[model samples]
Target: MSILLIDSYDSFTYNLRHLVENATGAHVLTIHNDSYDLPREKESLNKLVGSVDAIVIGPGPGNPDSAQDVGIIPYLFETFPKTPILGICLGFQCLCLAHGCTLGYLEHPVHGQISRITPIDRNSLFRDFDTDFDSVRYHSIYISTVTDDIIPLAYSEDQCLMAAKHAQNLHFGVQYHPESVCSEMGSKLVSNFWALVEKRETVPIRDSHLLQTEPLIKHFKTTLEYDYKYEKIPKVDILSACERFPDPLLLNSALSPGEWSIIGLPEPGRSLVVGNSREAGLTVGTWKGETKAHSDSLWSYICNHMSQRYYEPTIGDPELAKCPFVGGFIGFLSYEESIPLTVNKITSGPTPSTRLCFVERFIVSNDKHTFVVSIRPRDKEWIQQTKSQLQTCSEPRFLSSVKAKVEKPDKKSYEKSFYDCQKYLHAGDSYELCLTRQTKVHVPKTVAPWELYKCMVKNNPSPYSCYLDFGDARLLSTSPERFLSWNNQLSQMRPIKGTVKKHPQLTYARACELLKIPKEIGENLMIVDLIRHDLYQMLKEVEVTKLMSVEEYQTVYQLVSVIEGRLQDSIYTGIDLLRHSLPPGSMTGAPKKRSVEILCHLEDRIPRGLYSGVCGYWSVNNHADWSVIIRSLFNYEDDLCSTGTTRCFRCGAGGAITVLSTCEGEWDELNLKLDSVLGIFS
Candidate 1:
């Protein structure tokens, strides 16, 4: 069977064709009114209509009043009264006029306005309609009144007839456009219409014309209420879920309960033949920590390590060869005081009262490297499990290994030191000083080859980002820096450039202080300026909704700002704007191209994989949220086996360095950043 689609614009036809074809799996023949004359179009359409099973009039910009003299609607009804016909937007008005309904133009046609459907009667066309779902209206002229023979299937809140069906004829029309993505029940509406048409082709005419009266209003009302009340629900018991999972890395914790999970497998690639039962407990919550600097430090350390050991002239010049794989560095932040709560409860071993330190886990070259530098947990189970996992992996390296030879510090002394640090923090003697570090892993032989291809292809395609949180812990890491994410809107970018570190004792504090410096602040401000400029190009009015501010995250503190603007009516696809303004100012530094040159000249690698790229999703309403792909990894299939290593990860880190920046200090700061991930190994 085939369908006839009449549209004034090509875009409407392009979008609706997919929906119609997908629903009915039937051939679609489209006719553009503006391009074809009525006489020629009529001759062609007449022959096509007879062969097609049904006709669908698509939505488009144009006045139905202007097209009334064309007589296309009358021709269709007269030629194919027995065949089912559906009208959308302008076509709906024309259909109503053809069926003796009146149409008039409003002074202001509510374009892009959402109109709620209030069904007036039971009918197949309004099967999914009640009082809940809203259809997007994009027209100036609407059906003002209908005749007695026409059934008022749906109406807008303002009492305008949005949809109607003829009582004696197989004709239906909707004032609102359902072809656009903005139409809430568009897909369902099209599906129902096609189902009705299919039934008519098989059953008796009377049997196929039966109307449905069971109201779906209650279900829709409950759904809307639940969506509205979702935020008010209390958080679930995360600790119990974690205990059930046993792996701290895979616990589920987020704002919405039962929505997300953290899955932990052997880093890079670990072949575990376990089924869903074993994998179910291995998922956890998101991680809340800021470790960009630490990640940078780790990358620097890796470069240095490669320079000393893996560097080879034969594999192409070290300076020119792009890094083959992407890398990921994660800093899991926890409240400083919370460590003791989990540490003291260990059942099998003596609990240490040592100052809690950050952990670092690195995935380089596919293999995982975990480091535990400063704060050692007293829990034997936690420590033992971590050690066992590390040892199982080949060529594991350990730093700061206490030989169990030095006499253990007494609990009194350790507790006193802990309180001393806490006292100093509370008294404002010092800002909350958290330890940080980075770890470097050689992308194991298992998952290394797919790196180069991914880097080349994803240069700057779409703004991409992801957030997975399931109650116990949450991971809010995206390479692209998403400074502010709320209400289906997002502002993020890749921020790079660094300065040398000063005052060895005040690294963390100095890093925080430098972020506030006017020079750095101005650079960030310039990036915001560029973003605002880009936003204003697509939106009506732009606003710097958030000013530059220091946000203290788990492992590191960052300077974040926000900008917002009202989207323009003319702007259809946001991906175009995202593609045009990419490799964000934060990553490129001020005077973007110059910064890239400097980076290429200074850094030892190229194509930072998912490190500097962006990834995220866009909703059906054109509302979008995305993030920079910084602390992330790309997992690829291993060449050796079909089901071999399929996971690879990459993380990128750098800072704006002025003339005052020293190489050694930069190296130390980089290492400090890498500490958090490396600590995870220990």
Candidate 2:
């Protein structure tokens, strides 16, 4: 069963979706009340009303008396008598008029203020409630005379009826908007409505809409009874302390045959899956089973360390191109029986060490997988040097070894298939089209693995950066600006886009000075402008909460800014925002779609996969936190290897420009970025 919310305005829909879904787990569809230009006919109203189990008249602007003349109200009362109906605010006034009640206009309507609600009688809708409670009131029209058949369920202390139920039909109305945060008993009202719709067997109705006399007291008692103690268990160590590991880049090539299956690991009992079409992309387990914090918080924790460790140092000495350390981390929650896994930090282990850190786990579904990752020093220096050394010791692996199979359609048939897919998109069947194209790039030996690694290390501003030395296969690496993530009402976005190269004459301090140039600021602003525009489409008036500023990173100083926007009324799912604003503008140049097209034409591949894709979790409440997957490697089972062993390694790199970027400079920068992952090879 589903509930259709009609004419609902912004963010209000978000709260309503949450309320209804949580109470009954029913599908909720929201339709903009004004967006539809339906002919005011009884048949039109019936058709709209017939599509759902219940029609909730959502809160919106305009006088309630005006809506009655428009024909929706009269049609509802005259035609659909059996269908359950609900009205909030203006919706309530319309309901009263439709039920033969008179709407009396107030000289001055009190808006957005608290009022005392007094219960009139015992009913299932307000089954369990106290005699009185406070709720938000925002209406100018009052139901002066209710019909004989309608029973008054609740009224304000001033004698204005706040809630009424039809004795003859499954119809209800509330003058007070129950969807607002100010509605003290709003959630209970929704729950009661669900019970009625779901036809749950009930014993008897009680007076009052508020259930518990003191819900806060019960909550405190419940909190105190909860236990946090756990028994210490034996930890499992990796088989060998210093096994000669294969190239991290080769890991994906080795494990490609598995096609990224999700599996529950034994020791930690966490689900693990690796294999995204892109070398660094992710289709891993869901993040819902992990921590409760927002995604931006996690990104801030990681990026803050990256800025201090890698960018700051690189800015001081540009020649120091190699920082042989890099790692990835994931935070999540699993089953109660699953134990948290801890790996050695390698603070003083091998010459070049890296670690990925997993914070804490949260929730896991019966069929879903959950796991967290951690990589240490979380600085750019270690990441760059590690990759440089790793590359010097290894050979470039071919693409065929790791590339997933692509089935091409015949030329004549491909167009038809493409159009069908396009039709699906236009009809809102899918948000994105995932397709593949073959491409290649020349790998010059001048920028050897270590040389390139050093260049990137010297140039990078974050302590934690990534490098992908795909060799002739065409390199794709990324240094990301971890964007916004949210769980429920909380949401955030971090934007970073500014760069300065290390020249022989430029000292680390000089490089930081260079980053403050106006041209660089313009570039950063362009991306910010684009991001704000994209956000505005699905969000409310977005504010540049954090102005553009230069923050010191490991190797250099970076120009960073924070942009914030409130989610729209209809946008309830985190995935919805992701689908609309993906391949972050900071990473992709301004005019995102055009930038992508230009990259596709100039670069070697389409569908960069997880390399530029996001990884994170979406919780039960539709809140999510995801990160752009950079400075990471993929592992997979290799059937072609003589030893039949699985391969594992990481990939990293940066974006490009056709006009301003020279071939040699671009090539050098690419090498610099790859040094982090390559350093691990040596």
Which candidate comes out best when scored by lDDT?
A: 2
TM of each candidate vs. truth = 0.33, 0.35
Residues 1-682, candidate 2, lDDT per residue (tens digit)? 6676655332233444555666666655655554334464435444555656776766544455564323254455556778787777666777777768887755434444467887777566687886678876555567889898778889887888898877888778888756544467777887787778744223222212111111111110111211111111121111110011221221111011111111111113242212122112222232222322223322233333222322111212221112111111222211100112222221121111111232121111111221111122343443344334323433332121122212222333333433443343232122222222211212232323333333333333232233322221212222334565653344566776555544467675776577655445544554555566555445544566665666644333456777766654434333345545666655555334434543443333323333455444332223444545444432212211112232222243453332222334434444444443343332
The alpha-carbon RMSD values of the candidates against the true structure, listed in the order shown, are 24.9, 19.6
Model 2 scores a TM of: 0.35
Candidate 1 RMSD to the real structure? 24.9
User: How many Å off is the CA of 643 in candidate 2?
Assistant: 8.8
Candidate number with greatest TM-score: 2
